[model samples]
Target: MARLTKKQKEALAKIEKGKLYSVDEASALIKDVTNTKFDSSVDIAVRLGVDPRKANQMVRGVVSLPHGTGKDMKVLALVTPDKEAEAKEAGADYVGLDEYLDKIKSGWTDVDVIITMPSVMGKLGPLGRVLGPRGLMPNPKTGTVTMDVAKAVTEVKAGKIDFKVDKTGIVHAAIGKASFSADKIAGNANELLTTLIKLKPTTAKGVYVKSIFMSSTMSPSIAVDPKIG
Candidate 1:
């Protein structure tokens, strides 16, 4: 195993061994442990007591952070001619149909969130090979694929994010930035946790939220007590 750096060792020292902290405590501690020069993203990893492989047990949903994600989300609005103005007015970074589609076909996925209409989804089906793997594909469930292009684009710009449980039953998401106040970080984390609780599948038995960890881009994770939510 690689030896820990001086900074890494120092970071670990700040966290008590085997101690599970409350949401507020973990949020503040994460900022204290972050050693990155740039503003690092504060992420939350939630381990759920469910099997993702089972269709009925899958957990996926969207949440709008109360304090908003610190980073500006680059949104692409792929819409027909009539809806272009609406999309642009809603603060979409990029707006268009054929040209954007051609760019996507050419392996140009430079944007974060892609919001498009149901009619446009048919054209996007062929480009799934490029978008699917990157998790940029617009899905109806996430409200990314909808006729209300303006609403979708606005929501995404206003800190809306979608997350799905991984194969290992962990849902990982960047809740905010380390530069944000501890209260802001904790607020975002709580919002996400509450949403996840509401989305628990009926088939999921026992402890829905098994564990939660909060950390920055390169900081040691702080264990968050699941019961605190």
Candidate 2:
């Protein structure tokens, strides 16, 4: 195993071993432990007691963070000419149809979120191999595929984000950046946790949220008390 650097060792020392921190405490501690030159993203990892393999127990939904995610989301609005003006007005970084489709066909998915209309979804179906693995495929459930292209683009530009449980039953999402105030980080984390609690599947038994951890891009994970909202 690679030896830990002096800074890494010092960061790990700050965390109390076997101690579960509250949401606010963990958020603050994460910033303190982050030593990266760049503004590292603050992420939350939630372990749920549900089997993602079972459709009924799958947990997936969207939540708008009170304080916007520190990163500027690059949104691609794939709409017809009629909706081009509306998409541009909604702050979409890229707005077009066939040209953008051709770009996507030629292995060019450089945007963060792709928002398209229901009518255009048929054409996108064939490009699933390229978009699916990258988590860029527009899905109706995530509001990425909708007739209201403007609304979808605006929401994504805001702090709206979609997250789903992985096969291991862990839901991981970037809440904000380390540069944000502790309060902002805690608020975003609380909003996501509240949403996850509300989305608990009826088929899921026992503890819905098994464990919660908060950390920065390169910092050691801080154990958060799951009971704390």
Candidate 3:
């Protein structure tokens, strides 16, 4: 309820500039400051000033979070006939035959998250053209297209936030609300950071992490000079 005084603001800026926060520390700090169940690591990544929209900065590879991301992501599973039950048990909103090719043509625009096996991707070229623009295309490079249906759906539903690199190579994503505990964001951030560090492409030149920042939906960006670069 109180604003950060000059001294407090200065200290925060200093710590932020250092940009080293563990999951526990971030969660504890946020917990003491606010009461909200929105545990999003995206917020922490944003606090570090990591943009989520850059194509160069993207969510690729297998990033298994210790705690699933907290969100109600509508899931659509595309699988063969036999896998219908498996998809349903995974809690996918919609499970279907491999003919999802026609399905996406008819209702792809409305879906939030999509999971598909290699069998499905065979017919995905045109679909990619359609969904890529909408940011809904399932690219294996981004770990969206996988043979594991349940795992994909579970991660997506659990807030497995994906970061993508745009023309500028920067990405943007949501971690949680401003009221969320810093610890949640920190954990999410740690998971994300670890993934990125591990997946730095061979083509990527010097310093994968550029700069990071965090901010609430209504707050200003808290620039984080993590010195990872």
Candidate 4:
């Protein structure tokens, strides 16, 4: 139920599928076909021929969301004796206090998210190479290292989405599923768009939030109207 203007339709048709581009690449494509400024949500949406809200999150660190990410995150928690039972009761996928430090070398790959207590930081330091690249390392700054087990697990399940501004300062995140009510997706999209816009880096140039695409897992995106909320 979204309508595209003639110019917008042309821009959308120009972009090749599955070809991700940097901001400059994106801008050049628009200028080549249409001389309009590639600086607004509408412009970016038209260029991609898809909703900007459909883009998956580009998060750098992990956090626990109050409502969870809506995806089942296999969580591995590192806790001491005092907090061991609390972790299991909170639905942690794997809970322990370093009794299985050796196991951390193996099953971590099978898990989606990893949570570690402050005390275990010393031991986990060695895993910087193994888990860091996968974005699984627990760090306090990113809110991955936490003492609260229940809060962490609950948020992971709800959709503790994470995102980082790309080199171009564009923050991307999936707003919702295509079958979701437009209003619902719109609300979520607005929330994320607003947050990223507000969190723009002082050093970054040009527009902040950039393009948004909302689409199903395998379907094309439907551009959502980006409103300043």
Candidate 5:
């Protein structure tokens, strides 16, 4: 195994062993532990007591962070001519149909979120191979595929994010950036935790939230109290 660096060892020393920190405490501690020169993304991992393989226990949903994700999400509005103006007005970084579709067909997925209308979905179906793997396929369930292009684009640009439980039954998401104030980080973490609690499946018995961890890029994970909402 690779040895821990001096910084990594120092970071681990700050975290008390066997101590499960509260959301507020973990939020603050993560900032102190993250030593990256650039602003690092603060992520949360929630282990749920459910089998993701079971259809009845699958968990997935979207939540708008209270303080907005510190990073500005780049949005591509794939709309018809009439909706182009609306999409542009809603802060979409790119707006168009055929030209953009051609770009995507040629393996150009430079944007983060893609917002397209239902009518445009049929055209996108053939390009699913290029978009699906990258998690950029716009889905109606996540509000990315809709007739209201403006609303979808605006929401994505305003810190709205969708998350799904992985095979290990852990729901992971980036809540905010380490540069944000402790209060902002804690607020975002609480918002995501609260949303996960509300989305608990009835089929999921026993403890819904098994464990929670908060960490930043290249930083040691800080164990957060699972009971926190």
Candidate 6:
């Protein structure tokens, strides 16, 4: 195992061993543990008791964090000329269709989120191989594929994020940045946890939420009470 740095050891020591912290407590403690010079991202991992391989138990949904995600989301609006003006006004960084499609075809997915119109989705089908793995595909369920291109772009820029359970049945997402106040971190974390609870598949059996962990980039994980939600 890689040896822990002095700072890492100190951060780890702050957490009480075998104690499950409440959401607010964990959120505040993560700030104290994060020692990075840069504003590290506060991430939450929820382990659910569901088999993702079973389609009936799959969990996926979106939530709008009350305090925006600290990162400025780079949005690419893949719309036709008729919608370009509205898309740009909605804070989309890149607003265009064919050229951007060509760029993606060349493996250039520079934007964080891609919002496209329903008509444009057909054109995107061929680029699925390039976008799917990156989680950049415009899915209708996530509101990425819509007639209201501006609405989609605006929501994404306003801290709306979609999450899906991975093969291991864990949903992981960055809730906020370490620079945010402890209250903001806790607010965002709670919002996500509430959304996950609402999205719990009926087929899922036993403890829907098996475990919860909160941490900042490069910080040791802090166990959060699964029932806090």
Q: Regarding lDDT, does 1 or 4 come out ahead?
A: 1
Best by TM-score: 6
lDDT of 2 by residue, 1-229 (tens): 9899999999999999999999999989998999999999999999999999999999999999999898899999999999999999999999998999899999998999999999999999999999989989999999999889889998988899999999999999999999999999999999999999999999999988889999898799999998854
Tens-place lDDT per residue, model 6, 74-165, is 99999999999999999999999999999999999988999999999999999999999999999998999999988999999999999999
Ranking by lDDT: 6, 5, 2, 1, 3, 4
- Scored by CA lDDT, what does every candidate get? 0.94, 0.94, 0.60, 0.54, 0.94, 0.95
lDDT string for model 1 (33-128, tens) is: 999999999999999999999999999999999898998899999999999999999999999999999999998999999999988899999999
Q: What is candidate 3's local distance difference test score?
A: 0.60
lDDT top scorer: 6
Model 5 agreement with the true structure over 52-91: per-residue lDDT tens digits: 9999899999999988899989999999999999999999
In model 1, the Cα lDDT at residue 197 comes to 92
Residue 187 shift from truth in candidate 2, angstroms: 0.5
Error of 1 at 121 (Å): 0.7
Compute the lDDT for candidate 5.
0.94
**Can you give the lDDT of residue 103 in candidate 6?**
95
Q: Compare candidates 4 and 6 on TM-score and give the better one.
A: 6
Better of 1 and 5 by lDDT: 5
> Which model, 5 or 6, shows the larger lDDT?
6
Candidate 1: worst 10 consecutive residues by lDDT?
Answer: 220-229
Give residue 117's lDDT in candidate 3 (0 to 100): 79
TM-score of 6: 0.99
Better candidate by TM-score, 2 or 5? 2
Query: Every model's Cα RMSD, please?
Result: 0.9, 0.9, 5.8, 11.2, 1.0, 0.7
